[model samples]
Target: MDLRDRTHWIFDLDGTLTVAVHDFAAFKASQGLPADRDILRGLETVSAQRATEIRTALRQWEADLAHAAVPGPGVIDLLEHLRGRGRQLAVLTRNTRANALRTLRAAGLHAFFDARDVAGRDSAAPKPAPDGLFRQLALWGAHPDEAVMVGDYLFDVVAGRAAGTATVLLDTHGRHGHPDSADLVFSELSELTSRLATQPPGQSIGGPHASQKS
Candidate 1:
């Protein structure tokens, strides 16, 4: 159960690596889109023309925000620690792959990951689908038990769990606002960095199991 020993790390891009900049409420409101459900899923129910408009706007907005992207507290150090271990890493995000790479580059983390390791909406079904995680793990020939999914929201937790990977909640700023939703929880990424940096090998971070399925 010691997460530091896990060989493959799957991270959510926005809130986990970069500070969350997407204000879904404001963006959807400005787009005249409904606020009842997931934005990407909602796009499917709209007219083709309308969806195209929204998507174009979305890509532009994401581009601007991606350039302004900042790393979450202690994220750089966390990534450095993981990379130093020679472990496999990947980003499973709800954004387009181009935007994800842009964000990583702007946040000064582009070198830690291979471009092929960043899985985005265009490459998979998105969070809660587990498809992105599955594909990335397959690419590495890694088992779900060897990976840990770190993210900052309920969908991330759901996606990680569905993917059969151990999940860590990076809930800085209290935005996640939930309880008992992840295999491990940390209020800031710095704390996770400290934990991983100091924990002895084979020591459990928490939980009684790694990520093996029954």
Candidate 2:
């Protein structure tokens, strides 16, 4: 569908808006987590004290990364387009609000969003859960159908699906990821902008293929 016409746009911060800089494997190693395990999920298996320690380390790591943040290619253009159209925008990230704002400012993207529109891990249950998205929608006085969740990973897609919003996977690597949950996929944010600009509001944008079930 003409996603730009969607009234509210909820985006993932780290990989989707800012360039992906997280060395997840190294971070997991540092946290004494298994490489294959999701960091938040893995933390649940640890002692409460250990989990707290890991969380502190993760926050530090994200803070460090935020200082060097750069906007992903086409991020500025897409955001400008959305803003010009007067669309409601917000960020829903697993990162802390402070870090998300830091990255946005460093990337020169902070002006496009209001602080109240940003939802960090502290604001709601993190992605793969729909709470953050639901909270954003509620704040905007919007229904899920009037919004779309855009992100670069499976959690983003799953969370959007669970929230009943359309999902767009920013699969820059052409991995064909999160097929079942994502309603659309774009290798670049510019592609999303281009399609949205050219298509009618209700028209569908074709995708490569849907995800295969195991």
Which of the numbered candidates is closest to the native, going by highest TM-score?
Answer: 2
Candidates in order have lDDT scores of 0.86, 0.88
Q: TM-scores of the models, in the given order?
A: 0.92, 0.93
> Per-prediction count of colliding residue pairs?
0, 0
User: Which portions of model 2 show Cα errors greater than 4 Å?
Assistant: 176-180, 207-214
Model 2 lDDT, full chain set: 0.88
Winner by lDDT: 2
TM for candidate 1 is 0.92
Stretches off by above 4 angstroms in model 1 are 201-203, 206-214
lDDT string for model 2 (95-197, tens) is 9999999999999999999999988999999999999999999898999999999999999999998999989899999775446558887788888888777
Residue-level lDDT of model 1, residues 145-197, one tens digit each, is 99999988888889989999998887766665554678888887777787788
Model 1 score (lDDT): 0.86
Cα misplacement distance, residue 37 of candidate 1 (Å): 1.0
- What's the CA error at residue 19 for candidate 1, in Å? 1.3
